[model samples]
Target chain A: MRYSGFQVIKEALTGHKGWKPVWRDPEPQSHYDIIIIGGGGHGLATAYYLAKEFGEKKIAVLEKGWIGGGNVGRNTTIIRSNYLLDGNEPFYEMSLKLWEGLEQDFNYNAMVSQRGILNLIHSDAQRDAFTRRGNAMMLNGADAEMLSTEQILDRYPFLNVNDARFPIKGGLAQHRGGTVRHDAVAWGYARGADMRGVDIIQNCEVTGFRLENGKCLGVETSRGFIGANKVGCAVAGSSSRLMSKADMQLPMESHVLQAFVSEGLKPVIPGVITFGAGHFYCSQSDKGGLVFGGDLDGYNSYAQRGNMPVVEDVCESGMALMPMLGRARLLRMWGGIMDMSMDGSPIIDKTHIDGLYFNGGWCYGGFKATPASGFCFAHLLSRDAPHPNATEFRFDRFSRGLMIDEKGMGNQPNLH
Target chain B: MIINHPLLGPRDAAEFTYLGDASLINRPDWQSETAAQDFYEYGYLRSNPAGIHRELWFHEAGDRSWLVVTRNTVTHEISNVEMARDVARTQGRSK
Candidate 1:
């Protein structure tokens, strides 16, 4: 069933009578080809690709919450491939490519609007850094352009042309980067994968790992024990906890990142804009509200509720960038738990255990990289060989001192 | 008086030093300064202000303790201003 945006809404309204979940084996199948823990974007996408690419139809994706109820649903859905490090550039570009063709591929209107993303430069140092990054993107065959102040103004006239504190310099505009409907992307993958006979189990939390002689055999969830030959851990927030239950620790910190939406207004902002000096970026939602977010609350917190500091900081920066937002009241605010890795890059590799695979450490950029991450992760899981682009993002890179420290920011929660 | 310089740029001098805490310098606003001072005196607050840059000191180690600072570049102001040791002690006591 190739469903579009309207069709999906209609189906939801009319009730999915014909659709039966493939994961519900009445007799309870003893095992599956692959078991994907966590039904977020990464896990669902992985399941989708496993069935679509490798022809592994007996795949199961188990989620603790309803589909699209995790960070995949909470994130500010911005997509970009303007990574600075060598290790991340190619893979993110691949993700960007997947994002480009996602709507057509899923037959779902993800609203993947490539309105372009502009990372504003504040200092001369920042300008040089963006220049280098833009050059790298160009060398890697990704679309990126450096815009001047006049060019920026010509493009986004609503922005403050003269702000003294952080003067408006040009930005690194990735033409391919943009925003998508966060929830729609998740539902699209769920509907698409479910159509291809993949079982998506919700309200099923993995309590423990079924290990036999140091190898993951299956998962013990709240629902029941499900056996699997291969198990993939795509759980983001609970990655550390799950791995610890298996007596392992990946270099990850769970932090709460918050996002805010302003009162609905006529759309003024066209593309996504990120501030270099300040931890803030915003995009206009289809409903005309200005959706934006800033740095994570600087403490180890699994609680999804963020403090007022981040919200105030984001709003202040928004006012600085576009003064018109001063009068615009904030409509709502929300938070998501991000698994911030030490290197700020994701880990897609076979774990120390033979059959157990892990895919996490997405930081705040997981929503946009859903397709590419899923594809590469699926390829790695199916072939037992890491994709060429994501080879450096191995779990052992931390011990080896080969960390891909993009943004020149350290792995510490406070810094990230 | 609004001092406008090329490097540091223009800012209202009246709004320079915070109103509540004179020990702390360059607080974002009166409300924030009061909040910080309230936290400092009482050792806790329901919530902390977001997105402000602040300079603080820690005094547990000695008469002059480690300075703790949190600031936001966009606002060009301090969000938190308190002693690191004080914060640690407060948090430790709470826990």
Candidate 2:
């Protein structure tokens, strides 16, 4: 049902029995025209756009677990388009635009809050780098404002300005960048796709792919063998393992990136604030909890839990940025496997195996790229070509020496 | 998590930088005819096993030495840790 204020008021006036489940739980069928593995935000969004925009039918999204159980739900929920690389800035800008209209387009309340994001600058070198990044962002059609320390202090007074080690000199602010309710995105896309006749089969783990004679046919799942003419793998951190079934090794590794939310407190942080001297970013959730995260656990693992040193280091950075956070009690923390690529970018291209398409290596930035990743991936699957904005994200970029090294980390997945 | 360093006793795992598959130390000959393909394979591909794995860890903050760590990815348990220089020397790696 289309969610609206009228429906809510009508249901409130009535017995509130008019509401239905957000999406249906449908069983699988024998065959489908297209099958999308991993029903996270990307997979569900691909199915949604394929049906809603591309007019493709007979689509099925097979999820090993329930929806919103992966990195889609385990992120800090920040969204921004402030990228430096030409190959990445435009695509992320497209995603930011899509996020601007997501709640209305899907008729779901995703809580897309555009409060703004401030990447705090601490030194002269960082200021120059941020200035270049801001120019790049503005050139790519995304809003970016260079705010002085006074302007940042005017907005966020809680930031530690007296710190001598890493003083906040300035900040690169994106007024359009902010956070959203992470799980609601997965739910909205899943509901949208289910309404458009896309069968979303949960608990259907793909055991192997049906590869014969260098051509793909279908997948062997825990439920049974399901046949599909075309198959797209949007599995985020599990890309290496999932593609290994088809005997394809990806140019990526999985590392655990953890996120944390503090106990409920009064509204403090007006928007997302990232520490420049270290890897820590935080924002106040609508529920009054401080949501934040930092670097990965620096290891190759598929496990969903992280170690403690990263947590200590993250809190150290937070306390360094805002000394008052030392008083706030830690509520809880969780980890999600990030598919870190060599250049810290993503890969959305067709594989040598016919009828198989792969989309992964999103690292910690996957949550923000949900809309555009899906739209571009759907474009690729439907038209057999990459979208104009996403043409740089190819599997051959590394081999051809066209790698989009965003962090300039040079083939280091963890560093990125 | 604490990784028992071979020379430095117990140290936090956060001080170490992870590089997957200890086999990367055995770099292919740069002058070989298939050097491009070999480097491509060396740069990208991985076994990425779910169980025990032999990996490389750099002590970036402490000794500035690389360590060969055999750890279990599933259980987050370290089975063995050795100096990567020693491991490379044993493998007859020069320069």
**Against the true structure, whose TM-score is highest?**
2
Candidate 1, which CAPRI tier? incorrect
Place model 2 in a CAPRI quality band: medium
Q: Summarize candidate 1's per-residue lDDT along A345-369 as a digit string, tens digits.
A: 8899998897999999898889878
lDDT of each: 0.76, 0.92
Over B1-95, each residue of candidate 1 has an lDDT whose tens digit, in order, gives 23232223443322232111122332234467466444332221111222343333223323433434454422334344454456556545322
Reproduced native contacts, each prediction: 0.00, 0.62
Q: i-RMS values of the candidates, in order? A: 14.7, 1.4
TM-score of 2: 0.97
Per-candidate DockQ vs. reference: 0.03, 0.67
Q: Report model 1's interface C-alpha RMSD after superposition on the true interface residues.
A: 14.7
Give the winner by lDDT. 2
Steric overlap count per candidate: 11, 0
